[model samples]
Target: MHMMLMADEKRLCKRFFHFRIAACARAHLLRRSVCAGFLTFLIAAVFCLSLFSAAPVKADDKVLRVLAWPGYADADVVNHFEARYKARVEVTLVDSDEALWAQMHAKGTPPFDVLAANTAEIQRYTEANLLAPLDLARLPNTRKQLPRFQALASIGGLTSGGKAYAIPFTYSSMGLIYDRKQVAVAPRTMRELWNPRYRGKVLDFNSAQHNFSFTALALGYPHPFQLDPTEMRTIAHKLVDLRRNLLTYYTLPEEATAFFIQHKVALMFGNYGTQQVELLRRAGADVGYVIPDEGALAWLDCWSMTRAAADPPLALAWINYMLEPDVSALLTQRQGLANTLTAPVESSDSARIVWIGPVENIQRREDLWARIVSGDRSERF
Candidate 1:
């Protein structure tokens, strides 16, 4: 039977090639070179089709659809994964959490197979029943991560009802960034952004969640995420102070890097932490990164499979592949963020990182943040 199929394919290719050559010769209106090239392409296609006709193609072809923040699934990274699994990988980058949420919830079911999101964002997806229950047994690489992340159930948003929903991948703090040439020494605390000397020379993140939480931290609010009414007012006043002493607020890392160089920005709220530092340094700026004495807010981005995923085992394989040392090392080499596979020297275990959570009132904070940015007086609060 196999010999008969091969003979049929060979005969079909011969007939197809002869027809193409005759057709090319009849095309007197076309350039001779162009017609010859087209004929050659047809012949090659026929030959290749005949060679691969016996192979059965899998329905999925192990297509791994990934949705993550910029730098998480870069071209080189995706290419490596694709080569290893002999699979097709599609990566979608989202700049903001809201954009991620919008993309995931665009239809009834999320389009992505696996998504990298923060703990808070994961909670939203879980509540909406958009995430799938993870099979940790398939993800043996999770065991190779740091001991702190080994207990997924103890983590606030990772595990629910005895089922693990996500696995930790990378994390970083919203530290302070200062131009070394402008500032002789590293800024020890986040409060330096409020220093009067650097007034009109400082930049801040343009998000309410970060603005409010960091201000609450600087104001010594015991609970930054769940601030009391009085704490809210005080934090608002402090935020107004931050606004008064700023050049402008920026949202994207690329924008911040450009503005820092063009404006000679002295200090900035490093919302993207080491990621921004890498961008600035690459742009030929001398800078220093410091996690303030008062502690900096941090985010842990994890990988979770979407409920709409077509192939569960393939999704798990991608997660396990990412947890590999070489792949995780790319996080630091390419993006300058800390991966969870191993602990780094700069990120001490004792360092204080106020993990982000659902805020007491995101809407109220956003409204107040707008007022503050518009030059509302402290007494107005």
Candidate 2:
């Protein structure tokens, strides 16, 4: 009986060992299956996430192309507009009116939706049928502008056949900027630019229209823009003489400030007016701005839409956005330009501000100015 019990125990032990081995094998297979399933899921999830990441958030997103001067469409300002409108703004800055004109007329280039130009240029653009007349009703913010700006017809070059073309944004007199240390007293007249004492120490704007206009003002011409052939010839010679005194001709205000500091320049033709003064003072220079006795040429830059605007509503929105008090105030606070909404802190009460008018002949002035800039002799004029 004891032998029989021993055999039974041995059999039971072998059977228990076999059962345990089978259980262990089953557990191992279950874990492997779970892990493989998890790996497949993870890979598929990652692929889907990458596809979503690569696609555009909005397939029908709009883009606004703007052509303007520096400080007109600053990055921060544009970013605000983009966020508010849910659109992309591409800003192209031009330093001079000539550069602006060239960009507007460039062949094979993508057209701009809106642009900033002086009233005179607005007239030029209108006559060429390059600009579309604005619907003032669409621009509600224009109501916030001063009475002078609201009455567009009262302002020259902004209307044609009783239809307004542009809305005024900012204005500044093309005054004179002088280093306070070098110029003991404020310059009394534009003639000071030609003074022998400041020769090789003066800086001038590299603009043909303005150069001729201001020189005509200094020479006491009844109509600077309406100069006859003889007056044009005389003004051209005067510009040649003025060129002899220039340290250099500058297109942008920042470039003028750089030259002023690096070379210790004494005087500059402030094409940008108080904007240059603000820039110079910020750069740690003691400078003063003055509108000469003959009166300073001023510009009233306005916003206008192009004839080829892809979206007229979007273009009008941009124009209206510019006149917003906050946006217009930024023009005054950051750029030292006077906005149409508020009174400027920088006073021009002392000097006359001659708003620029359309020239007698744009091509003639351009041609003469080109030769003058290229060092043409006085006799050639």
lDDT of 1 at 133: 96
Model 1 scores worst on lDDT over the 10 consecutive residues at 21-30
TM-score of each: 0.78, 0.84
lDDT agreement with native, every candidate:
0.82, 0.87
Residue range 1-381, candidate 2, lDDT tens digits:
999999889756644543453354346456756978989899999979987886565768888899999999988889898888888888999988889889999999899999999998999899999999899999999999999899999999999998889999999999889999999999988889999898678888989899999999999887988899999998888887876567767788877787788768898889999889889999999998888888889999999999988888988999999999999998878988899999877669544888999999888999998887666667767
By TM-score, the best candidate is: 2
Model 1 spans > 4 angstroms off: 1-62, 107-110, 370-381
TM-score of 2: 0.84
TM-score of 1: 0.78
lDDT of 1 by residue, 226-275 (tens): 98888889888888767556767776798788678877889999888888
Q: Which residue pairs in candidate 1 have backbone atoms (N, alpha carbon, C) closer than 3 angstroms, thus clashing?
A: none
